[model samples]
Every structure is written in structure tokens, then in C-alpha cells.
Target: MAVADTRHDDTVTCMAARLLRDAPEEFALLGTSMGGYVALEVIRQAPRRVRALALVSTSARADTPEQVASRDRQSRLVEAGEFDSLVDAAFRGLVAEQHEKDLALLDIWRAMARTVGAAGFLGQQRAVVGRADARELLSTITCPTVVIHGADDRLIPIEMGAECAAAIPGAEYVVIEDAGHFLFREQPKATASAVADFLGRVDTSH
Candidate 1:
């Protein structure tokens, strides 16, 4: 439940270091979206310390050139005080088209952006842009693992989740139907059920 500040750390490696400094010797890790990239770095840095890992709506690959360019553009916009527009743009991509009509959900995301503030968002964008390709580390993961993707996820495709599960030795995979990038928010029951089932099989007795 410890939430380390990732705003200042501009790379997954640095974020991983900060995580290890505060985390217990052994702990289960759960991450979604950008957090997923950070979680994979943690496993790479301290494989023996993680009891299990759960990745939701994320990918193990580095961003495509177009993606990086878009992120850079967004970063500039945020730095110039277009924070509200950045959040709005992100929200449009983070959910299924239908969820765009969900005013409550839209408001919640907007509030999150405001809470983090412009500086924090820019830092996060830098970290996200600087993240490395973690696909090679998947085969080295010995702990139990779970991968959850939304069937209608617009940000990261469902194929990315499948490939992540396939790379891991014995990773469990789940697809939340009718959900998008924010599957946990869009489909809580299914997301919680998948997490519960994964936890049931994890041995954190040590």
C-alpha cells in the first residue's frame, strides 16, 4: 500500500531504486498503466524480493517513435500551462468511447490531474518517455504473476497483455470485457475478482 513518489524520478531505474529504499524485503506488487512499467523495473532490480506481480492495462515494450513524439508534445503543452487540456486529452484515450459520456468518471480523472498539479504531470511524462524496454526481463520472473487487460482498452492493446503473459513462465491472464484502459475503474467486480483469484494462489508466507 506504500505509494512512492514517481514524479521526480525520470526513469524506471531511478523509480525502482526509490521503491526498494522504502519497500519491505519481500512484498506483492500491483501496478497499472505507467505503474506497470515501474513494477517490471522493480522485478528486474530485485526479483527475489517480490512474492508476486499484477500488471493491468500496460505493456513491457518501450514506446514507439510516434508515441514518444506525442508524449513530448504533451509534455511541452503541460509545461506551458495547458494542464487541463492534457488531462482532457489523456481521459479521451484512457477510456472506451462509451465511457467518455460518463461525466462522473471524467470529473474524477480531472480531479486526479489537478491534485498532482502541472509540475508533477510533466515529471511523470518524462519518466514515462524515458522508460526502457522490459520485455527481456519477463522470462526471468520466477514469482507468480498476473496480467489483466481490458477488452476495449484504447491506450494499450489487448495483444500486449497476452504477449506479456506468454513471456512469463506461468503468468495468469485475464481480460475484463467491455472495459478500457482504466479497467479497475470501469469494471471493478471483474478486476477485483481477477486480483482475488491471483492472490489466493500466491505464497507470501515467508
Candidate 2:
């Protein structure tokens, strides 16, 4: 359950993948959002090491032109010392319509953004912007995999998660209803159950 630092490098997701070079000989990998992008790169770099994988709230395709432009604008805003404002704007897009007024959630999210700071966010933005299309690599994934997405996700569409499952042989796909980009936060029990069930099956199979 070790977390990889995806913010240290600003150039590519490969840098983040390298952080796992000294990880256990074989381990299960789980990632959300940009973390999922890094997880895919890890699979690409060392498929044999991952016994199982869970990709949550992420896309296999690279960023669209519009998405790239949006991220660029965000980076510019951060550079101009408008990080707080940028976080505020992004908060709306990170959750479902129902959570727009979730003040507690907003506070927690804001705190996380502040902890990451402007530089880290900029680095993450650049790495995401430069990430490769992972669709081609999906077919090559022989390890057990699970793709979990939120039914009400506003960030990465649920279709993308379905696409990942469809492409990866024997992959399990679970969509948590009423959940959004932050599905784990929105429906922690459901999210945890799905992941635990998938991993339990993987463990039993192994």
C-alpha cells in the first residue's frame, strides 16, 4: 500500500514509475486519477512485477487538445500565484453535481491542494499532459486487473473505465452509482468493497 510520489518530477510519468524500482518483487498496484497514469507506466515498464492492478477514476487515452489547453491554463494560473483560485475552480470539476456544496469535502480537498502546493500541482499537470496513450498497452496486460469508476464521474468519463476493462482480458469493471471523480471519498464503503473483493479473488486465484 505504499504510495508513489507523482509530483517530484515535472516531465514524465516514467519518473514516478521509477520510484517503484525497489518495491517488492511482486505486488498489487492501485491508483486513482493521475496515479492511474503512473500505474500504467509502471505496468509498461515492468509488467512481470505487478501481480494485480486496480485503476480508479482514470482514462487510458492521453489528454485531448482541450484538456491539455485546460491544464496549461491551470499551470499558468498557478505560476501567477493564483493557486488558491485555481484550486477553487478545480474543486467544482472534481466532484459530482451533488457535492458542489459539500463544505467538509471542499475543506479537505482544499487542504490537500495546499499541501501539494503550486509547484507540485504544476509538475503533475506537465506529467499528465505529456503522458502516452495507454490503450495499446491494455491488451498486453496479462495480470489480474480491475477498473473501478464512478457513475457520476465528471472528470474522466465512466466510458473510459469501461473501455479499459473491455480491452484488458478478464478485467473486472465496477461502477459506483452516485459517485464522482472522488469516488472513494463519495462512497468509501462501496469503493472499498469492490477493491477488496477484486483483490480477494486475485489472492485466491494466485
Candidate 3:
């Protein structure tokens, strides 16, 4: 993915369509945080093409007013050349207590922020804040789905994963303890195992 903002594909639906225009006829989807939103949109757009889904530390609900305001404030700070506070705020809920002080992990996050820069951040903020509620999209998704969440995720909350699993028929749910919003990174082995198992069980013979 470009990793930059939607880059003119502002809406989730539009971005999903963009990916499908040249994507494989069928593929697995593993979405983390905002990516979960995009993946749901993709399912909505083309359920037939998605062989499986792995939703990680994300929600299907619309942004709360407080969340929108907070994102806007953070965007402003980025515009004003003050990104440290924003990063600090985001990082606090991103990892377990032990990994919070890990320089390597912190560096990876910092590098991503710097790579996206101010413009991409603003675009993403707009896309997220304006995104739709995907709760209703769950029932329509027929692909093999696994909902994974950090047991101690501060950003998306653990219950959100259960809610998604409950909404999506036949969706398996897993929790990674000692992880936070950045669960896949914090517990890569477990995360990969879950993903691999799900893919292996998929009925691709059709």
C-alpha cells in the first residue's frame, strides 16, 4: 500500500474499489486499526474476492464526537509543527508496559509518523473522522473471519473485538494478552500463527 493518505481515494469504499481494480481475483485481508475500516469497506464492495479476513484491534463503529475532536486537535498540532505531543498521546496506548520503553519499537512508530508526514496525517484524519459505521456490514461478510484484539488495548478496547465477532457470522475471536493497540507488532508470533491457521482452513478449492 502507499501508506500515504488515501491519495485522492478519500472514502473507504473508493479506496477499496481502487485496490480491486488491479488486485488478485481473491486474497486474504489482514487489517489493523484504520486498515480494519478499509477492509470492511472492501468486503462491502466485493465480498466474493475476499477469501478471509483478520480484523486486528479495530472497531466498526463511527467515530465518537470526542474522537473526532481529538483527531482534529492532533491534526492541528501536526500542522503547527508540534507532533511530539500527538505521538506521545498515541504511543501511550499502543504497547504493553514492558515494551513501552523499548527503543526499537518506539523508533519504528516514529519512523512511520515521519514517513506519513503532515499531509498524509491530515488526509487520514479526514478519512477516519468521516468514515461510516460498519456494524451493519458484518452480517453480509461471508468470508472466513478472525477478529483479533489486544487484551489490554487502550485505543480500540477489547470488547470491540467481541462485538465484531458476534456481528459477523462464524467469526472466530482471539485476544493477545500483554498487548495493546499495536498487538500484531507486540505479539507477532501469535498473530502470525492465528493468521496462518485461518488461511489454512479457508475453502480455497472452490
Candidate 4:
């Protein structure tokens, strides 16, 4: 699978969307969180190219004023060379309450944060702050789509994922119990099962 580069560009969403120009003529698209925003942008920019879609723990609405301020604060923290502090602060919101002390999951998050670096994180924050509201675009989607959300997500609530699914005709809505924003990491087997089932159906239909 080809992963799009979300670093180095201040317009991270647009940059990642542009990368789809190089993707196969048609392919399934799966995205989580900020990547989901990028996926919606991809749908806007090239609707005909997507064969199927899976959006995990993401929202179709644009960032709220409070969210924008939070991103700005995170950017400032990175600018002040407090990247670890920023990551630490965000850790609680990334997982279920029971998984708050899951060292293995935290380690994975920390490693990903280090790989993304301060600059990359800052760019992504900026991009998220400026992303478009994709609610209207959902109804236009004709491809098979699935919306997966953590039942206990503290980040984007499950209601938002349900809204996305409701807007898209024939879209499937899945809620993973005992999970939070990082449901894929918290409940990998269930999350993967849902995705595998969706993809399996998509393949069979074609």
C-alpha cells in the first residue's frame, strides 16, 4: 500500500491530496483522523478515482473554534521545543479510559510522534485547522463507504461518525466498544474485521 507524505508542507491536506495524482487509476481509500480529512479532500478533488472508502475515528465537520485554538496551542508548544510535553498532553485523549496506562500503545504513539517531528506535527495542525467541512460532499458519494468510530471516543464523538454514515447513501456505520479515538490501535482485531468485511463486500460486488 502507498502512503501519502503528510510532512514538509504547510498545506498538508492539499499536499497529500495531490499525491493521489500518482495513485492507481482507481483504488480503495482508507483514512483515520487528519488522514480522514485528507481522504474527504481526495473525494472532492477526484471522486471518480475512489473505489471504496473507510473512515476511522474521524469527523466530517470542520474544526470548531475550540479545536482551532487547541491546535494553535499545540503548534506553539512544538515551536517552544516542548514536543514531548505536547505529545504527553495529547495521550489521554487518544485512547480509551481503561487503556490510559497501556504502555505498549503509548510507546507506539511516542514513536510515531518522534517520526513525525515538531515541524511535521505543526504543519498537520495548521492543515487541520484550515480543512473544509465535508458534510455536503458525503451525499455525493456513490462508492461503497464505511464509517468506523470508537464507542467511547473522547476526541471526535461517535455521533459525528454516525452523521457521516447517514449522509452517505448505503454507507455502513460501525462502533467498536471499549475504545476511544485510537480504536484501531486499541481494538485492532475488531477494527480490522470491520474493514475486512467492508472490503470483502466491495470486492464481491464488483
Candidate 5:
């Protein structure tokens, strides 16, 4: 059970490989956001080691030029000591338009940003912006793959998750309605239930 911060996929891949080398018999990957990108990379690097995979609020494509530019702008702002503004912008992009006015959601987003901090956020943005397309790799995934996305996600649309599911044969795709990019925070129970049910099916099969 490892949680990787937003860093180069190689770092996470190396860590996963090392863990598998030490304990090849027991290893699974579960990741969200940029971590989900790492999980996909790990599977590509060491498919035999990853018993199962769960990707939440993620995409199989590289960042678009516009997105990359946006991340760079945000990174520059963070470097300029405008952490609060960066956090605010991030929160605005993560939630739906309707939820933007919800004080509770805003607080939760702020808390999440505080935990990650400016440096962490920039680091993650860098990694995400530098990621490669994982579509080709998805076809080779042998283990049970679960993709969860919020129907109302403003960051990565639900169609992206559906595309991933379509590419990965037998993969399970779950979309939680009324939830935005931060599904775990906005709809924890539904997200948890979907994951549990997916893992349960995998457990039974294995």
C-alpha cells in the first residue's frame, strides 16, 4: 500500500518494480488523479506484478497543449508565492459549477490543497503534464482493471473513463452521478461501494 505524490512516472514505476521484486506474490495498485497515471505506468512496466488496478478520476491520454500551458501558468503562480490563488483556481476547476457555491465543498478543497501544499501541487502538475498516452498499453493489461470517474467531473470528463474501459477488455467502469472531479470527497460512499464491488468480483475470480 503506497501513495505516490505527483512526480515522474519513472519514480513511481521504479518503486513499484522494487516492491514487486521484493514481494512478487502480493502487490496491487490503486491510485487517483496523477497517482492513477503512475498506476497505469506501473502496469505497463510490470504487468505480472500488479495483481489488480484501480484508477479514479484519471485519463489514458497525455495532457493537451492547453492543459500543459495552464499547468505551467499555475506552477509559475505557485512559485511566485500565490499559493492561495492557485488553490482557489484548482478548486474551481475540480468541482461542478453548482458545487462551487457550496461552502462545505470549498472548505474540503481548501483542506486538500493545504495538505498537498504549493510545492506538492506543482510537482504533481509537472508529472501529469509530462505523461504519455497509455491507450496502447491498456490492451495488454491482464489483471482486473477498474476505472471510476464522476459523471459531473469538470477536469476529466466521464467519457475519458469510458474510453479507458473500452480499451481495456473486461475492465469495469463506474461513474458516480452528481459528483465532480473529487468524487471521493463529494460522493465517498458511492465511490467506496463501486470500488468494493469491483474488488469483490476480482477477489472471487481469483
Candidate 6:
């Protein structure tokens, strides 16, 4: 199983298709945040290639105006060479209240942001802001789907995950309390355990 990471929708979709064409029988998708969005798009484009899906801290709607504006501001800040502060501001809502003071996780997130840089951030923001509503696409998804969200996620509200699960027949939803948007980083043990359990069920059922 390979993990395909790309910020742009077209690139992600194309890569997913290529992967599916090259090795149709061996891949289970697990994506977080924007990657989750890409994963959903892949499922839409090539449902037969996917065995199971794990959607974490993601939404089915395009970015709100406020979010777009915030992204614009972050882009400007990044262009102005205030990358550290921009990363810190961007990741503020990702970590839980308790882990807000955890410098280690903050540093890791900051490093990730800096590594992506301004151009990548702007491009990703544009992709997110211009994305189509995935609610309709959810109903067409027939694979064993697991939707994971943080109870304290400020980015995409937990209700969105609930709604996604409700819309998709037999989709499982899990909310990790005290976790934020960055559930994998903030609560890795619990997140991994939940994902493992979901995968186990998927394997048994299939």
C-alpha cells in the first residue's frame, strides 16, 4: 500500500488513477486533512481501486469566505518572510488546548509549514477554496468508509463528520475527545488505535 501526497487536486487525482492502473489490487487509502479531501476525490474518480477509506479532519464543502481571507493573509505573511509566525498562527487551531503549550508538536507543525513554503501554501489554499461540495459524492461511495474527527476541531466542525457518516450508508464515524484538527499529532495513540479497529472490522467484513 502506497501513500500518495499532493497538494493539488488534479495531481492527486491523476496520481491516484495511475496508481490504480499500475497496481489495481493493492491499496487502501488513509488521508488526513487536505489529503483526506484528495482521498475522497480519488474515490470518486476510481472507486474500484480503493479497498477502504479513512477520512480525518476533513469536510465535504469548499472553504468559507473567512477561511479564504485567512489563507490570503497567511500567504501575504509568508511572502513577507514571516513564515514562522504564519505557521504558528495557522496551526493554532490544530493542536488541543492542553497541547497548545507543547513546543515539540508546535515545532513539528511549524517545520512542516515551512517546508511547504509560500507558493505551495498559496496553491493548496486555492485548491481548497475552489473545491466542489463533496456531499453528493459521498452517497456514491460504496467502499467501507471510516470518518474520523476531533471533538475540538476548530477547522472542520465535528458535526460535518456526523453528517458525512449519516449520508454514507454504513460509514463509521469516530470523534476523539480533547483532540483538535491535528488528531494524529495531538492524539496519535488513540487515533492509531481507532484506525486499527476500523481496519480490522473492514477486513473481517470483506
The TM-scores, one per candidate, come to 0.96, 0.96, 0.91, 0.96, 0.88, 0.88
What would the per-residue lDDT of candidate 2 be over residues 1-206, giving only the tens digit for each residue?
A: 67776667875555645657657778899989988888888888888888999999998899999999998888998999999998998888788889889998789889989888898998888899999999999999999999999999989999999999999999999999988998888888999999999988876233
Kindly list the per-residue Cα lDDT of model 6 for residues 1-206, writing each as its tens digit.
56554543334455455545655464678878887777777778778777888888888776778988987787778789887777787677787767788898988897888777667776776666666678888888888889999999887888888888888878999999889998988889999998999988875232
Error of 4 at 161 (Å): 0.4
lDDT of 5: 0.78
Between which residue pairs do clashes occur in model 6?
none
RMSD to the hidden true structure, all candidates:
1.1, 1.5, 2.2, 1.5, 2.6, 2.5
**TM-score, model 3 to reference:** 0.91
RMSD of 4: 1.5
C-alpha lDDT (0 to 100) for residue 58 of candidate 5: 88
Off by over 4 Å in 4: 204-206
lDDT score for residue 133 of model 3: 98
Candidate 5 residue spans exceeding 4 A from truth? 5-25, 204-206
Highest lDDT, which number?
Answer: 1
lDDT of 1 by residue, 19-96 (tens): 988999999999899999999999988999999899999999999999999988988888788989879878988887
Worst 10 residues of 3 by lDDT: 1-10
Comparing 1 and 2 on lDDT, the stronger one: 1
Model 4 / residue 122 / CA error / Å: 0.4
Cα lDDT tens digits for candidate 5, 57-81: 9888888899889878888898999
Order the candidates by lDDT, highest first — what do you get? 1, 4, 2, 3, 5, 6
Residue 67 alpha-carbon offset, candidate 1, angstroms:
0.5
Candidate 1, superposed: residue stretches over 4 Å from native: none
